[model samples]
Target: MPAQNPTGLPFDDIRHLVATMPAADQAAGDMARARQGDLLKPPGALGRLEEIAIHLATWQGKGMPSADRPMVAVFAATHGIADRGVSPYPGAVTKQMVGAFTDGKAAVNQICSAFDAGLRVFDLALDLPTPDITQDAALDERACAATIAFGMQAIAGGADVLALGEMGIGNTTIAAALCHALYGGEAEDWVGAGTGSTGEVLDRKIAAVKEAIAFHGAALSDPLEALRRVGGREVAAIAGAILAARHERVPVILDGYVVTAAAAVLHAMDASALDHCLAGHVSAEKAHGRLLEKLKLKPVLDLGMRLGEGSGAAVALGVVKAAVACHRGMGTFSEAGVSDKA
Candidate 1:
């Protein structure tokens, strides 16, 4: 039996939850594959669309896949490392962007509206930035657990698909630190010019990541400890949301680099956490491709997009819905009065 806690702290026993996450239904996927063969088309003609439908069926635990209720949740928080000039934008931009999301003025808001998907933004804490991870822990255990609980609540009333996004001024720095810690790479390999930083700003960002990793490398082998030592609240919440979505058997669509970094944290914790997820798009961020390679996720779209806030995932939702429609609405050869090949 999966462990249950009545105190509402989902992250308190995350290992147990991950251990008990229901595996994707292979029978349903097999059935979906059989149905696809019966559809009136050359085998594999539809290519990845057919494959996506089958994958969705397995995660949804049904022969017919559906992405009817797509939800995009964006978590926003402040990072103390922003003071080190890791990004061109100021920390206040995090709150301002949250306001833009709430007012339906951000790019992600417009994308969600156009796609007819629901959007929710969580401001973890703009004014209360996490401690500078180069010198101290980013979040204590209690705060980390609480923030994770906050993200787990993102899927409301049984959303069919969840997309995770984040907004933090210096998150790329944290992401670089986290990736270096998990993957054992140099800072230059994972760091990038986030928010349009370049030249001296980008160099400083890289140096900052290098310094933080050197300071905390010993504790990083433990995923949760690494998150506490170097992750933003938004990053922690995104990880929590991914785990919660998997527990509920709802498929999750990962957005860009920072968001994928959160998924990386979950992947480090439990490899199965990725069974219920798909890469929505490949971001232009440098480390994004490596991250997807690490997760072994094939992206649904690629347009050189690096604008986070779930925009890429929201755009990719259309493709997911189309794939589901193709899976559920197409007619079999018998139903279409067409003869099957021997």
Candidate 2:
């Protein structure tokens, strides 16, 4: 994983790449809605499904589109802040749970299996052995390079869309801190109970996030520096994936608060980075709402979920697929000779 943007494409190029794809998906959705109108339904009888069709049309770059091959890329890394007790669980759980995900013993695995999605697990920090199950594994000399490169490779590996999830107990602290610095919020405001901590431990968690935010404020002036400051290997990796997804022209599905934090950093670095994103779901964490508002994103679901295992995004995959189907399949007004509101 050499550090090479050999083309030296400006961030503008990346921004353009990321920014322009939604139009295609949008056109697709519009076409779908037009067709649905022809299907003998009232102009807006299908309700939200019409919007879904339009969204699908846009996402697929066609008038009719389907989310046939959605993909999930979950990155796992250890964090230094876990040493400060920011999380109720130990940092060891990051590697162990990632191992479990790779071993197909986690919720993400079952969800992906159920959805028939292509799943990727990356050891961006090389903290654990590459289990037999990871579809793609990269361990290189430079963690940052490898992590970013892994993102490129994931897109090249035929992921229609990308979902970013992370494992690391204290990661919420780092992510919250990054969110504060990137989005100009207080760390206490963004920090939440990761892994379901309560009482005194939660208080400590909030304090730890505030501390990290204060310490990292200077470095956070630059997006990459902010990523380096409080970001775990997995988060940094997701940042790369976000940029790469933009470059590769794919829709990115974001999970909970932390992933939104990564998207926030990416957005601050390049505002157009958000153009390709479809927010998966709202998290129970309060920080998520603020971050989502900052990003101006509306989540597709609200399952009262606090889990950060990409499960929410996985569920959104189904919705996206259904949207695609509606766009591609439903009939239009003219075809059915239904209405005259043109």
Candidate 3:
């Protein structure tokens, strides 16, 4: 029997939701592919843009896909591990950045405005940070479940596509730990200089991840337990949002490493959860490349971006829009009175 949640939504409920989420429309994808060959341009001339259109068509279940209503939700929280010097910035930066987001001053805000994307920031828990994973669980089962439920609300406004991002100091450390646990690798492979940490701070971050793994490795097989033990509220919420977006048939654009880590949690919970997701960009963070590889996703952009807060995803939205336009607006060779290959 599955354990009941304090929110009256058990983990099984989440599993069922994921399992029942709509699969991509294979017929629509095939139709898009057929149309791509008939476009006036040489076949495969647009490369990834052509593939992106097919992917969008499949996920949207429509012959002509449009990313007209993209939403960027930035989930913010503070981590108790920030006090351990994992990040150069103080934990207060999280709240300050959230304020900046609300005031439309952050980079994500600017990118969202430029792309005409709806933006919302969720302060998961600014007043209290999640407990250090090296000492104990970051969140209890109840809090974790509720945080995930909070993430599901991002799609209520009828967003056609969703982009996930995070704003939390020391969260890179949490993301590293979660990646290591879920993907099974050395702590060094996953750790990076988050917020420009170097020297002793980087060493401490790696050591903390090792300690947490040693303590919790046995129980990580259960994805929810792994999240409760080492994941932050924002991470859990991002996973929930991804699951919910897929359930709603809204495609998701995953941001940098931390956001991808949350998607990794969803992937772990159910292999099909990410079928409706796209890798927005490959972050400068080393683990991000590995995360994308593990998910077998090729990022739509690679601008050497490491900034979180969904800035990369927001920028990639332009590429997505172009892809959709190319698919829907291009004239066929016959319509253009052009000769086809003999």
Which structure among the candidates has the greatest TM-score? 1
Q: Report lDDT (CA) for all predictions.
A: 0.87, 0.69, 0.88
When sorted by lDDT, best at the front, the candidate numbers are: 3, 1, 2
Which digits, one per residue and each the tens of the lDDT, describe model 1 over residues 263-341?
Answer: 8888887787898899999988989999899989999999999888999999988888888888889888979899877
lDDT of 3 by residue, 1-342 (tens): 122323565665666666667778899999999999999898899999999888888888887888889899999999998998888899999999998888888899889888899998898869999988998999988788788888999898798889989999999999999988898879999999877889999999999999988888788778888888999999989998998887677888999999999998878877877888899999889888988999888999999999999999999888888888898898999798999888
Candidate 3, lDDT over the whole model: 0.88
Cα lDDT tens digits, model 2, 85-192, are 656787778778878987899999998888888888876554642211111211222554455555566576666677777666777776777787677756577777
Task: Pick out the ten consecutive residues of candidate 2 with the lowest summed lDDT.
Answer: 130-139
For model 1 the local lDDT of residue 278 reads 90
Alpha-carbon TM-score of each model against the true structure: 0.96, 0.84, 0.95
- In candidate 1, stretches whose alpha carbon ends up further than 4 angstroms from where it belongs are 5-12
| Model 3 TM-score relative to the real fold | 0.95
Task: Report RMSD (Å) for each prediction in the order shown.
Answer: 1.9, 5.7, 2.6
Please give the clash total of every predicted structure, in order.
0, 14, 0
- What is the lDDT, from 0 to 100, of the residue 272 in candidate 3? 75
| Candidate 1 residue pairs that clash | none
